[model samples]
Target: MTPPPGPPPLPELHWLEQLIERGHPHLQAREMRRIHVPGGPSFPVHAITLGNPDPALPAVGYFGGVHGLERIGAEVVIAFLQNIVTRLAWDTGLHRLLEQVRLVFMPIVNPGGMWAATRANPRGVDLMRNAPIDARERVPYLLGGQRLSAGLPWYRGRLGDPLEAESQALCELVQAELLGRPFSIALDCHSGFGISDRLWFPFAHTREPMPHLAEVQVLKTLFDQSHSHHPYIIEPQSAQYLAHGDLWDHLYLQACENTGRTFLPLTLEMGSWLWVKKNPRQLFSRKGIFNPQIGHRQQRVLRRHLALLDFLARAASSHERWRPPSDDRAQHHAQALAQWFPT
Candidate 1:
């Protein structure tokens, strides 16, 4: 005998909806798109926003789940959102901070992929590699991105097609909320990297440094100064490997079109291998390889990153106070080069 079929179980989306309702009249949630899987249930791409609406105010976007199999990414973002929402009723300092900065969130960018337990979306395209940009230098074969088949890992959508819905939604949200501001930051979280965590900035599509390397160095310095024992390795994505169609590189380039604006995009690639090392049995599950499957371990992961997210919010709110003046900009730039691109 066979069991009856059931609707796809997406607790994250459900929880997100409940969260929006709980945050009624405060945070606004918009459906970016409706993702319809051929045989499975459809999912809504939600973008939640709160804080100042003025373009003059700086903003920070917190994103996750660009690769669906990495549920921990989405969970970390939602945990931070939850932290903010729950504090809204009583945290006067938070309310003041919100008045000065904008916060955008798309905690589950690829819910369809999460439903199917795949790295690629339901269409088999990797959302992270679906942007139109190509690597300026040679990239690792296949892993960098490929058009061979959707059946393969790291499959970019077919050439000449429009960006994937998830990718488009994210790009649109960033352009509308984060770009054009005097200063903005983006943090897209993911897992399944090496034994150590990493904070990667732009130019994943090329070996060349981004125009804002000096600002990146400042941000890294501030973070290090505040959390001396923080468990993150901050550097350019190029420091690891280059890839084609990297969405951040494409978006960062678009942001640079405005000389007056500063957009510092960062990706938090969590070190899932540490979890797998402690509990080697997690290797048997594809999702487990990218998430902390144990109850307490997952809680710890969420707790630790909350501080980083909060710091970004506070940093965006006060970017003017810290960004270098013209007199010191070159000095900062030289310092950044020596540290990251030592001769």
Candidate 2:
């Protein structure tokens, strides 16, 4: 008898497991959930955590591979994790930083989708669109998420049904590891949006600015002051398009439910169109649309985002120092409104 074949094995998953083995004594890897394909093998969803566990301390979460087609996002996160694990051997500064903040990584959130080369999970649900949210404003036909058939892209799972397993895993992880903290920042990476890289904050369901717009603005200001020449269009997700069932938006809302807690989630939308522009042949490859097809280009993409990931961790550890006092928050809000939500 022939056994049913599972999706081809995922390279990212293998590399991540290896890092976990090597990162022992410094990092902890837990299999949060396992999703079994209806007729094939199952895959594990992992949450890698390090640093202080105190809920009073700040934290940062690095997430990637929500959409299976965007393998580069997962690769970027894995590269960063590998860098940290390698440094755990003797980097005094990194070790000290780890003591002050909690850092979590879910580098490959949708392994089944990645292995199958589909944007949606094995059950045909788009994890990003599987949250329970609806747009207050008009959304693009399908890109903004839909309750249509699973055969279509950006399909939100059946209404009134529990979230897809991958979505549930992310939500549960964020609620447990992030929402209860004093402060936390989450960065979810993806690509294939435009020619310029973008850093988007929440309220993807509406154009209205989020309550923590002032805090987000200040963080952007700090980054700009330090990096000086970084190339990223920092803005709210609504500025580009509105979407229904955005997982980050859903999680941010949950964090907001806690009084006195500050949770800022950022989505890194890398611009892969330029890769296609540079190599016209990428237009013909499925991976090329959402990732850098050339070997060197892929490496460069990985290198480019490492600093940003590290910066978020550093910023989270020192958020209290950079976030303004109540007396000054109004000014920050005013500035943010003028720049991002001007009348």
Candidate 3:
């Protein structure tokens, strides 16, 4: 029997466009375009802003698909936009919350990878590992027992620099809009591994937490409160479990350090055992079919993710404070999610 086809391109694009059009009037929207690898596709990064662009109102930026095969991340982002549109149409509280803070959504960062269904760019550079950081001492483990080198799958690329066109484009966008700004939090989504859902912070080179560790802990707490089913595991910057050259490291440590702003970058790793196809090569083959069990689970997880994002956006917009920082212990233990969803 012939296998079922994977998600089509037109339906995804059409759904995104419709969501934006319907929600544009309720939120501030901008079209940011970037050229993919030279002589490649021209990708559009949509920036949606809700509420006034006030410095006091903390902003939340959501991006996904830094790697191509991680299409579930992109789907979650689109789902997020659709959920917001639906809420705006029926929920008054949601419309008011959206109008209080800005939420910038870049659904797909690596369009080239999206097309190829590969992690690296067409030129063979891993954008995640291409950040301008020293990855020589920190190597990522591949599927096999062998460790990845600089030119391999998880390669840091061309002397720890951003050589890929998509990487360069993302860096430029960060500098122009996100960096040197007063955004309190940012989330980048990805899917792989059936490990527990995790909230990863910065500093890939060392295990030390970011200077704003207390604040990050607070935010993690808030996230935990938002969901009862999917528990969130918050860890230090450099855990022994994963190593080196992550985009969050570049953003939170490098960019925020240079700009002197406290931008807490969180890497949300969605469990992939739910939606990922077993035989990835089959996805490209005509006889390949999507695993229904995984897809359904992914859809459910996507809804939970959207709800968490909405809660975070609302908390940031209102500048809600969690438990009173009476002492260092109370302050450190207080998660930001609690502030977002006060009980």
Candidate 4:
């Protein structure tokens, strides 16, 4: 068997490198190269570390494109890196933030799916719903008045287990690098359904909050406060609507159960409708790259969203209290919710 093909170099990738070079002097960016399969693509997962590489500095993991069709998530992660790079060149505050924390980012985890524009990998498995959890069951979906099941878009795979090569690669990376480390937070980006902007936590199998529920609330409050002026962003548990074996649940929840480390995972669901109008191709192409118009609109949103992330990075790095319950919390959360679930 041979290694998987490397991700086709994109114009945006160079832009990201330049941004980091210009904006963040304290941070170091390195690529973690891995073989997707025995004879598959050799994809690179980009890691940007701030402060010391030592375990002392709490780490934050940011990932996008666990679902191949959700290319917008990957683009957003790139945009965030670019903005942070651009901002830090002139901003002392951001520079200080970079000096305090480390951020590990895997912009595109499913290169095979990304290349083909399908939600699942080459084997047809939904990576997001493919964690090693018990609530992993397949259900049928009626889309456009047609029945779709695990064999389709959100297929759980054979016996509701993760069988995709991409899934295995991600699992290996987490165990080798993330587990038992001082990772403070993790954010997985995704899109579809144009639902409200939300922050989803783990334990989708049960409504009961995990032991770190208070920490989850605190992080949610911080996000709400940071985007208070923007008026779009809310906190929604992943299992609120349905239960499944999601990536976050597998990482923070499952990992916590095994290692006893307090790691909080948040799913940042940005509103896709804002970009859908500009990029109609996404609506049609199950595995097609986003149209330029939709891509541009997404870029704008990504820029603003990146600014908020920068603010969060700063706040978290400083170990500042994000509490006191500001009036803007509800409004911003509502605004974000309205964008996806508009009344």
Candidate 5:
């Protein structure tokens, strides 16, 4: 019998296809949706799953490349998957860890944009800003999100329309895979801004603290204690700026409907300014600003975030042990307010 067709021609997708081919039997990859670009061949948005499939098990959803220019974001997630797939051969410990966790990866979420070298998808919509939710407060002219023109950045798409195909695909995946469980964590990676790495939580549409602020505090505490010298600035997305139609914000708000479910969505905004500062020539290249052009720097960036990704997986697995106790929830809440909502 003949084998299925290979991934479409693209470096990131090609690498992912290779991993899927190599890691077969140990992992499963499905094309969530096929994205077609104008005057170009279609590309598949694949979702790779590993570990337990039990609804009772906690899950972690790792997403990247929501913006096509942020190739580094997709690379980081791909690197982590490569590490896990290779280790599954000999890492008995990881095998045990998988028994209690469900891992979902959608490494290249916006392939059309990546192919065209634009931040927006082929339809010109920004997937990250393509959700249905609107900002409670006034957002910046165009950066926050706009319906003015798809030609402008951060386009949210026309009002009263269904979500863009990519946005709908992501929401469907999260709802089916992550929201049904008792607890789940999502880490969506992106770059192309700032000078320092940042870990942001929800409420990108508002400045108000999320319902799970206390739980966020506990996770932050665990991360700090375990990786004492970690160089991430953990805070709410609103701390930097509020935006309209953040997909995570939409999913997070939806997750709140199930009072028993705990869904903590995080955005890893890796600062690209550091890369540009080290090599100013990147300023002129569209992709260079969002991705590490230097081979060594790309490797270093991948190495730096692998631990954090692994930490989230372990944290989700052992959540019963480290998640804040009922007796301490109030204290954690108070502390969270003081730390992230300082007056």
Candidate 6:
């Protein structure tokens, strides 16, 4: 008798597992949740931590695969992790850096979606749009998140329901590993939106600038001073378009509720349009639209973003040196408001 074929495997998970094996004694991998795909085998969502574990130390988080189609995002993160692991044997500076800063990696957040080749998980919820937050201002129909049906893109989970397991797991990890610290940053990677790479901060639910706008401006200034030729368009997520149930927005708000915590959550939206423009045939393929289909381009993409990731680690570790003082906070806030909130 002929047996039914099984669902395709998740290559990202395999690659991450390999890294865990090689990073032994330096890396710590924890299973956040086990996702069972309907008619498919279950896959584990992992959170890999390294560096300082003390609550007093600053931390940075690297996340990817929020949308399963954006394989390039996950690849970029994995490449950076691999680079770090390879350097563990001889990088004294890295060991020194680890003494002061903690690092977290959840390179593949939607393993089921990656396995199923869909944006949403097997439960059909868009994890990014599955948070409890809602947009106060008008948002574009459907693109901003909709409750019409799970069949649609950007579908928020059912009203009045708790978050999906994946969403809950991510939140739990962030709250415990990041929010408790005095300073921390999160970079969630995604692609397939525009023609240029973008580094977006919170308030995707509205155009209102967040309280940390001044800090963001300072971070941008620091990034520009360091990487003069970088291509990212650093701005608020609402500057592009507002969306409902943004997980970062919810998490950032939660961080704000604490009296002295500073959490800067960023979204790395790697534009796929340029890739499609360079190779127009990519438009015909669904995966290609969200990823670099060509080999050299993929390698270039992986190589280019590693610097940004490293910069984030360095920035978090030395935040005390560069963070704006009370005397300059108002000036930065004024400039930021003028730049992003011009009426």
Candidate 1 lowest-lDDT run of ten = 1-10
Q: Model 2 segments beyond 4 Å from truth? A: 1-8
Cα lDDT for residue 45, candidate 6: 89
Q: Which pairs in model 3 have colliding backbones?
A: 51-99, 218-335, 218-336, 219-336, 222-337, 222-338, 274-294
Task: Please give me the total number of clashing residue pairs in predicted model 6.
Answer: 0
Clash pairs detected, candidate 1: none
- The estimated TM-scores of all candidates read 0.97, 0.97, 0.77, 0.73, 0.97, 0.97
At residue 336, give the lDDT of candidate 3.
Answer: 32
| Candidate 1 similarity to native, TM-score | 0.97
Give the residue spans of candidate 1 off by over 4 A. Answer: 1-8
CA lDDT of each candidate?
0.92, 0.92, 0.62, 0.59, 0.92, 0.92
lDDT of each residue in 2-87, candidate 5, tens digit only: 64587555789989999999899989888988999989979999999999999999999999989998999999999999999999
Candidate 5 TM-score versus the reference: 0.97
**What TM value does model 2 have?**
0.97
RMSD each, Å:
2.5, 2.3, 6.4, 6.6, 2.3, 2.3
* Comparison by TM-score, 2 against 3, better one: 2
Please identify model 4 stretches exceeding 4 Å from their true place.
Answer: 1-42, 87-92, 136-151, 159-163, 172-183, 238-240, 258-260, 277-282, 285-292, 320-343
lDDT by residue (1-343, candidate 6, tens digit) is 9635773377778888899999998999999999999888899989999999999999999999988889888888899999999999999999999999999999989889987778998889899898999999999999999999999998998999999988988999999899999999999989988899999998899888999888999999999999999999999999989999999999999999996889999999999999989999987886769999899999999998999999999999999998888899899999999998898
| Between candidates 4 and 5, the lDDT winner | 5
